[model samples]
Target: MKKETFLAFVALFLLTLTSVVYALEETTKTVTIAEQKADITGDRELDTILLKGVPYQDETDYLKQIFLEVSASNGTAYTIPLESGAKASFQLVDMNDDGVKDLFSSVQTGGSGGIVLSYLHSLKDNVLVDLPVPDPVEIDSHFLNGYQAEIKIKQTGKTYRFLLKDRKSYYKKLGLYYKGKLNEPTELMVNSYHSLKPITLKDGKLGLKGVQRVAGIANADTIAYVESTWAYLNGKWKLDNVKVLEKDQ
Candidate 1:
């Protein structure tokens, strides 16, 4: 479908409880609609724009399109333009309180190796901006061993805080490394977001636990996916489970 047509369909689909409108206008600056990306910046608004590119002729503004989540329902999907320098991508989530849905986007800064910056700009009208990485947790995806190291997060208020995670190297020792003298986990980080802890639940309570966890997307053909697990411990994330963590008891 044409960009304008798709934009209209999406806006109508998203207008669950609130009425929405779609507008695509041209800016004076030269824009790159070819490589646009969108993201949800923690807010619930739906915004889109083309990623900016290098310098160009004056007044050759990049094409700017404004999209609002016309309806707010779950599983609501939409296509947003990729900015000039942005890698085409989308982020879908339930941001509208009306049980509706919306989509955000992201752009790959470089090749597959470098970090691909993404955001959930629900905090405002799907506005595009640099994502802020938290400083507390450490992360690495070299060989994502969710079997022993899982990560999870929860929102405290305005900020999203790390929750719980599991030990890093227990896949070799046993199911968990609660009693073993393990080295401080080598932190794994991308965009500076650390998958330090993996949260687990064994009993009626939910806290930190060191256990191997693994889950892959179920698809006939294969597609990219995001999965991290962590366990909570001692007001922070330790590489082990809080349940059997020897020193704790």
Candidate 2:
């Protein structure tokens, strides 16, 4: 073989090797962000719970692939994949009142809306199953006349009105309103669960409370908050109550 051809072949091999190494570094990098010991299987023995994920390139705080790793005391291991986001964390609680501590996790999307993705899992009796989180409350919201906004909870047929006169100038500047009148019919922005956490119900059972934000025209536009309480009953999450409170502007 010619010397020039051999040198070209060597360069091509080096380039291919470099590409493969870079790909591996991007995909295979995993980090354990959180760890805890708890008796999740109801066996009275502590299990190792780990929250692991691969960080997005150049952003260590943002995970691209998040999951839960459990090393049960009964010689079993479980790996449960979860949605990717920033600031992934988990809590162990007996949410279902079944005497076994279930795993609940939340991940922040790091968006302007402050949206979060959450999950629930049961590791009881060495069986790994995902418990469903409560869905977002359906709402009908839009700009009202005279610099006001309205939100109606579809679940309970409750309506709420907000006096957004304080933001009239801001709204006018954004072409949303003109002289205290809406320029066009515009629906308010409703965001998913900004926060969901375990709360003790009045009956001493554990339940979940979620807070969702309602915005007008934009995310920062103040409107109101919709809080929903949920209870785990008969193997499903049941909505208990819905509350709509106006934002204190």
Candidate 3:
């Protein structure tokens, strides 16, 4: 082949290879940006926020580090620093009963189940401050009513009630339940309870209604246990009231 012909063929081949390389680079792209309206600052006004993250892949699954960007209506923007390895979720709740909503979110701390680590951003003087949850009692099931937060925990069959005082969550255990025959609490025992179906207190008694395991076997099917109520007397939850609907024989 002539010199000019050979040069022309080389140029065309290089152009086609570059195009393929560009297409391949575009296909494996992973970073993404998303936006949502949330009341992060505890103000009634809905603020615009952006979530910027990149896909992180591993042998089992994929996760991301979602960085939250809060934008004010007055053209001011702030970034709530979110670290790596933990996923985030956001919710607006009036935790202090101050008419304005507080920001609620959680970051996963390696548990596939049970309660993950959570964060409460309570608005202090129009600024969001990180209010850490009280240690030792992991959040099992929570019920938010106006300014009161009734939270149950894993292992224990008692409910912890917290009242919002002075723009913060305060759980004042009065040590009121002195007369009650309660079961010895065990960890991961009440895992069968439904999370979406909230267990509530009515007429001063919080009932425990769920299927119990047969002879406490690991893989055996559960049997319907009789209904029982935990009474709230004085200021603490008590298992003094037991109304057995069906005995677990």
- Strongest candidate by lDDT: 2
How does candidate 2 fare on TM-score?
A: 0.90
lDDT per residue (tens digit) for residues 1-249 in model 1: 899999998887788424323321222234343332233443444334333343234423322332223222223444333444223344344323223323344444443333343343343343433322223323222223333223333222111122123333433354332434223443222332112221234532232222211121112111112233333333333332212111122
Q: Provide the global lDDT of candidate 1 against the true structure.
A: 0.32
User: For model 2, what is the C-alpha lDDT against the true structure?
Assistant: 0.89
Model 1 residue 242 lDDT score: 18
What is the C-alpha lDDT profile of model 3 across 16-37, one tens digit per residue? 9999999977755344355678
lDDT of 1 at 122: 40
Clashing pairs in 3: none
Task: Show how many residue pairs clash in every candidate, following the order shown.
Answer: 81, 0, 0
Cα displacement (angstroms), candidate 3, residue 113, comes to: 5.1
Query: Each candidate's TM vs. the true structure?
Result: 0.26, 0.90, 0.40
Regions of candidate 1 where Cα sits further than 4 Å from its true position = 1-86, 95-98, 123-137, 140-226, 229-249
The numbered model that scores best in TM-score is 2
